[model samples]
Target: MALLLQLFFAHKVTALSILADMYKKRLIEDKEVVIASIVGMFPMGVRVVVLLLAPVAISVLGLKLGIIYVLLEVLSKFMVALIGVFLDRKYLAGGVLEYITNVSLKNSMLDAFKQFFKVLSILVPSIFLAMLLIDLSFNSLVSQISIETAHLLIVVTGTTSTIAGLGVAGSLIATNEVDGKSALLLLMIASALHRIVESLRFSMPVNISLFGSFGVRLTLILLLMNELASIFAILGLFLIINFGFV
Candidate 1:
């Protein structure tokens, strides 16, 4: 239940901090707690919402490509999370199973909610600042970008900085630089390459601050999982494109 809530309300650092707290408190006795968190922190639904609202995603990609993008993200995240769950099972101690077996469903739900919100305070400030940054300068940021690697820039720049990629892709589409299917494929690759640099800034410091050396390892694991998911998505995209299903 904790993992389910985390998956739905994913804020990576916040989720990790909460998990780290649970570990410290011994509320969770699993050595693969990190994996458990990863399984639930994919942000699939959140990204779909973002895609729907973001001007860049809508204007450049259009409805079809936008839907494709959402599908890819959802599928990739789901696949990766499922894999993490399976891997976690290998390391799970009997205690968690026993705890689950003994606990009432109502109590389990309540505890999951409590654990999930333990780091809400940490997330709120960051959310506000990020929204502020986007409101103040997102248009300007997107407007100034004129680059060929728009897709790559999108992923590398992280979610907040996608305005730049939006501008670049929008321009490219306007000028007939790439067709919709082609652009979709390019963007697909970029999406798969995502959070590369942004993860360092947002993920590294927060994880390290909360979990110390363990946080470092955790951050690395998170990055690996993201890349792995991206690879899986890109490969799927390739197959789809090659098969004329684009």
Candidate 2:
């Protein structure tokens, strides 16, 4: 179940659906689902990705904004720890040290490995397919963006995809068409606005189909939480830029 949680937890709606289903089935309580909502948004894999992307962001967003980007990911993780892990520790399970007295270490390890890999075989491929489809769709949208518009166009392109926007922003910055600070701000605006559009088209409908009214409710909560975070980030960035504080 820890492995399954690891798999689902990265995709926010997927995580919420699983957790919410658990609640409906009485596997866990409502607070477990709601409080751990941040985990549905950030998850463990995303934290790893954030670290991996830090240097790339530095090169694209430059030193200051890049650091801010990393901090945003950290903020999400911190929320998960405070809200999710604190409320529900069941997924943490037991370690070898903790299980040492209860069972044969060799048998335990062998059985655990077999069970984990058996589930992994099914889930890993499904996850890969989902990721590939999403990437293909986003890449198609990104390919449509024209970086020639520079400043304002960066925002438009960003609404298509952040990766697309970042590439466009980098080009504009290179040509001295837009500054790092303004580029980052526009990116945030595009990202925040895009989130709304995406929810309406994809997540909202899909979730409602699966979980009905509960899905609508959960979807809204997650969207609101994420949007609020983006709002604060934008305001914080604005202040730093305006004050020349980097």
Candidate 3:
């Protein structure tokens, strides 16, 4: 699974390189683009490594500490991004430092505050609408399922299908001690299938065809998740775990 995800990430990086090439003034050098993509893959690698090593870590460190280490490792990428941004500004022309120096701090703060509120304005209502829709749909479709299944349904279909939903669902799972495998599976499926409404909302203003974009994205996500390589990788992890290899 991790290997497949890396391949998908590489594909995205290739697309980004193509897009950069089309611009008259390239933001990043050709070689640097590939380097950046490889560097970016580190987080995915960390995720896989942590999951693979989790059993051993939990046994050695205890579950709470082990989970904390895993979370910190995942979040460490943000530090890497921060350092990358700093380097870009220090070494590259027309980087973020130039823009930062040009803008007034007060204005920047005000703009950030406005944007925060603006996002909240959109998000609060969308969340309520999503909740209402999920309530209606689940009641109609499968009202007799267990509480865990109900939560999974809400997470998959009743929230934004992007990173926002991932955070929300992850928090719920952690708090409720939900089955990790089930939560991961549902989250992946949700990421692929849901968010159509959000995608349409963003794409319409840019004149992109909603159906075309959604179809392509959904197909790619499903394909990557279901690919034989990914399946075998996941199976390998299970086999190792079952054999007490950790």
Candidate 4:
């Protein structure tokens, strides 16, 4: 829910900026840009709504039904995009669909392949190093630290190396007999905020500041999940999974 809200507002803001830029550069008329932004942001807004409803849907209906709803929502967005592209053809001087079908598809595929290799190169080595560290008695070192200190270390490791951090946390959870509440808190922080390094790597190629992405994600994680309330929320989820509601 939090992630969806964040992404939803981000997309709307980005669409507004894009429209302003387009109008300023005379790339499109004001009316056309308004329509285009609305069309583009519709899916993002719907995603927020769908995610907000997911918990209730899953609880009442079932996981399978909830997943089906998400898939249908996504497919509906795709249909809307297709329809918008076709409808806007006249406004775009008639070749937009063809260009998107051929040139854009090729470029997107090439970029996706490049990104896959790039991410794989980083992730594989990180995972190996994480495994190596665990075998070297790193967990023993962490066991000696105070619980608060351990949590801090986990968060730091997560920010630096995602795989290593997860490995360390898993080891601690399994062997240390850590408190369930604390373990859940640490897991939430590590999993959600651990992508700081990956975000930096991707941001650089897109001409975005690494710190900007890192700061935003970190802030959001802390704000949303770093509290007693969040711990209770996790407890609720744990209960739901283990016992279900009567």
Residue pairs with backbone overlap in model 4: none
Task: Tell me how candidate 2 scores on lDDT.
Answer: 0.58
Q: Which is the winner by lDDT between candidate 2 and candidate 4?
A: 2
Mark the regions of model 4 whose C-alpha exceeds 4 Å error after superposition: 1-20, 23-103, 147-154, 161-187, 191-246
Off by over 4 Å in 2: 1-14, 29-32, 48-56, 76-149, 242-245
Instruction: Rank the candidate models, highest TM-score first.
Output: 1, 2, 4, 3
Residue 168, model 3: lDDT of 40
Q: Best by TM-score, which number? A: 1
Q: Which pairs of residues collide in model 2?
A: none
lDDT of each: 0.57, 0.58, 0.41, 0.44
| Each candidate's clash count | 0, 0, 0, 0
TM value for model 3: 0.35
Model 3: ten consecutive residues of lowest lDDT? 95-104
lDDT of 4: 0.44
Please provide, for model 2 over 42-158, each residue's C-alpha lDDT reduced to its tens digit, 9 standing for 90 to 100. Answer: 554363334334645566667777777666645644554455565566544433221111224475446546644554453334334434534455444545664334545667656
**Could you tell me every candidate's TM-score relative to the true structure?**
0.66, 0.61, 0.35, 0.39
- The model with the greater lDDT, 1 or 4, is 1
Candidate 1, residue 131: the lDDT equals 41
Per the 3 Å backbone cut-off, how many clashing residue pairs does candidate 4 have?
0
**Model 3 pairs in collision:** none
